[model samples]
Target: MLQLYGNPRSRAMRCLWMLEEVGRPYQLVEKTTHADDLQTAEYLRLNPNARIPTLVDGDLVLWESMAINLYLAQRYDGPMHCAGPEVLGLAAQWSFWAVLEIEHLLLNFLEHRALLAEFARDPSVTERNELLLKKPLGVLNDALAVRGYLAGNSFTVADLNVAGILMWGKMARMDLSAYPELTRWLDACLARPAYVRLRDQARRK
Candidate 1:
């Protein structure tokens, strides 16, 4: 059996969604935000980084949510998995592009505006980053103008990874009226039956 240790509200949600998409039975070793559980010697042996999401599949131990999703995709040969080296390259490209273009910017906004106390946060930092995000967002919006999904025409890891990263924008509550194409694409991604199951399962846990 596969054992995945992490809370659903965290990055592990992506992995959970991937698991559901693959339709594979697995155990979710649900965890909390407590340091005691995350930093235990036993847990550290599986993930030296002491992260909440550590996937243990028999002799294989893996960390990092995106990589874990990729593993599941490849292992099960799901539709999200790349069909060849060329397609795999595109998946990798979109994944990295989303992280570099939007992930950190969204995190900056969340940490400054939502995580920190009002007195401790520097609104200027979040505001500046928010402004800078428009360029990359515009690029994404344009790329998605004529397509229903990223990478290829159908859903794949490229869409899954990029959509997961872009979801932070929804959390940040950024005004997205300008990116109609992006908004349309994201709505479709989040509306997937697999993603819905993932969300409901996480909430129940």
Candidate 2:
């Protein structure tokens, strides 16, 4: 059986969502960020970085949430793969693009609002994030406007990977209202039963 390590509320949620989409039975070994368990010898052996989300399938131990999801999609989503090589590459592109291009600014504001509240608040910083986000958001909005999903019309791993990152932006209160297409796309993607099931799982104790 596949053993996925980490709390459903963390980055592991992405993998959990993917697992649901894969329609396969797997075990979720929950771990909390507050606990020092991540640094424990047992956990560190699976992921040297001591990350909350680690995937253990047979002898293949994997960390990094995006990579794990990609692996899952490629490995289990089809007899060959749910997505072809082109879509697979697009999945990697969008996932990497989200972290590198979009998440930096979103996380900056999230750090200020969620994690570093002790620091003086600056509305300008968040406003700047909103401003900085316009270009990428516009690109996504335009793309989603033309297609039902990121890679093509059909829902693919790219949608899950990219939308998962965008969902983080939404949670961080990025106010994507200006990009209606993007907002609608995200709403549709997140409305999937798989994502909803993951949310319910996260709410569990």
Candidate 3:
């Protein structure tokens, strides 16, 4: 069986959602955020960064949430939504675009707003980061205005990956009113049963 290391609350949630969508029975190898867990030599061996959501399938080991999902799709042919690049050009496009565009902006906001907010320092840089996010959000909103999904008209990995990151804006209460199309698309993506199960798992953690 495949073994995934990471908490549901982390990026690993994406993989969990993919597994559910693919109907794959797998093991969730819980890795806590405790300092002890991260500092352990054993954990470091798997990932020097000691980040959550590492995948181990027999001899194969991989990190990075997005890469893990791609690997899962490639190896297991998970579900129609995650069809391989050759079979589904749009699916791959959206999937790759999610990490390429959407994730870049969202992660930037997360690091600058959430992580840096703790120290209350870098106020100037924070404002700059906020400004940086607007351009990407606008681009995404424009793209969504014409299409129902990021890659194509139907749900796919692109929708899941991009929506997963954008959902954070909801928790942060960062008004997305300006991006009505993006918001509408997100609503549609969140309505999926696989995403629902994935979200429920995150709440459980």
Candidate 4:
């Protein structure tokens, strides 16, 4: 059996959702940032970076949530799997875009707006990030408006990877009403049964 080491509240949530979508039998080992589990020698052998997510399957060990999800989608037979090389390329494109263009800004916004304590929170930071987000969000909105999905007509790994990052936007209570198409697409993606199952499981932990 495959073993995934990470806490659901972290980026591991993305991998967890992907595993659910792949319908694979895997064990979640549950390492949290708040604990020393990720720093231990045992965990370090799987991921030298001491990251929250590390996947172990046979002799293969993988880290990085996005990479793990992409690997799972490519290796497994499931709905999230890419249909072809072109689809895989597009999926990789959007996944990288999500991390590079949106993830940091969203994380900063979430921290300042909600995650941080009231006294520690910075309205200026949130305002700046919100402004920065408009451009990328508009780009994403336009893309979704064209095909309803990122890479293909139907949902695929591209949608899953992008939506996984955008989940933070919803958690931060970011106002996305300005981008109706993006809002609709995100809502539908998050509503998928596999995503719902992982989300509920995460909350229970």
- State which candidate has the highest TM-score: 4
Tens digit of per-residue lDDT, candidate 2, span 16-52 = 8888888878998978775587888888899889886
- Specify the highest-lDDT model's number: 4
Q: Give each model a TM-score.
A: 0.90, 0.90, 0.81, 0.97
Worst 10 residues of 3 by lDDT: 78-87
Candidate 4 wrongly placed segments (more than 4 Å): none
- Residue pairs whose backbone atoms clash in candidate 1: none
Question: Would you list the C-alpha lDDT of every candidate in the order shown?
Answer: 0.82, 0.81, 0.73, 0.89
Candidate 4 per-residue lDDT over residues 86-114, each given as its tens digit: 99999999999999999999999989988
Q: For model 4, what is the error of residue 202's alpha carbon versus the real structure, in angstroms, after optimal superposition?
A: 2.6
TM-score for candidate 3, residues paired by index: 0.81
Pairs in steric clash, model 2:
none
- 46-68: candidate 3 lDDT, tens digit per residue: 88887888888888888887777
Q: Residue 140 lDDT in model 4?
A: 99
The better-scoring model by lDDT among 1 and 3 is: 1
Question: Candidate 1 clash total?
Answer: 0
Q: TM-score for model 4?
A: 0.97
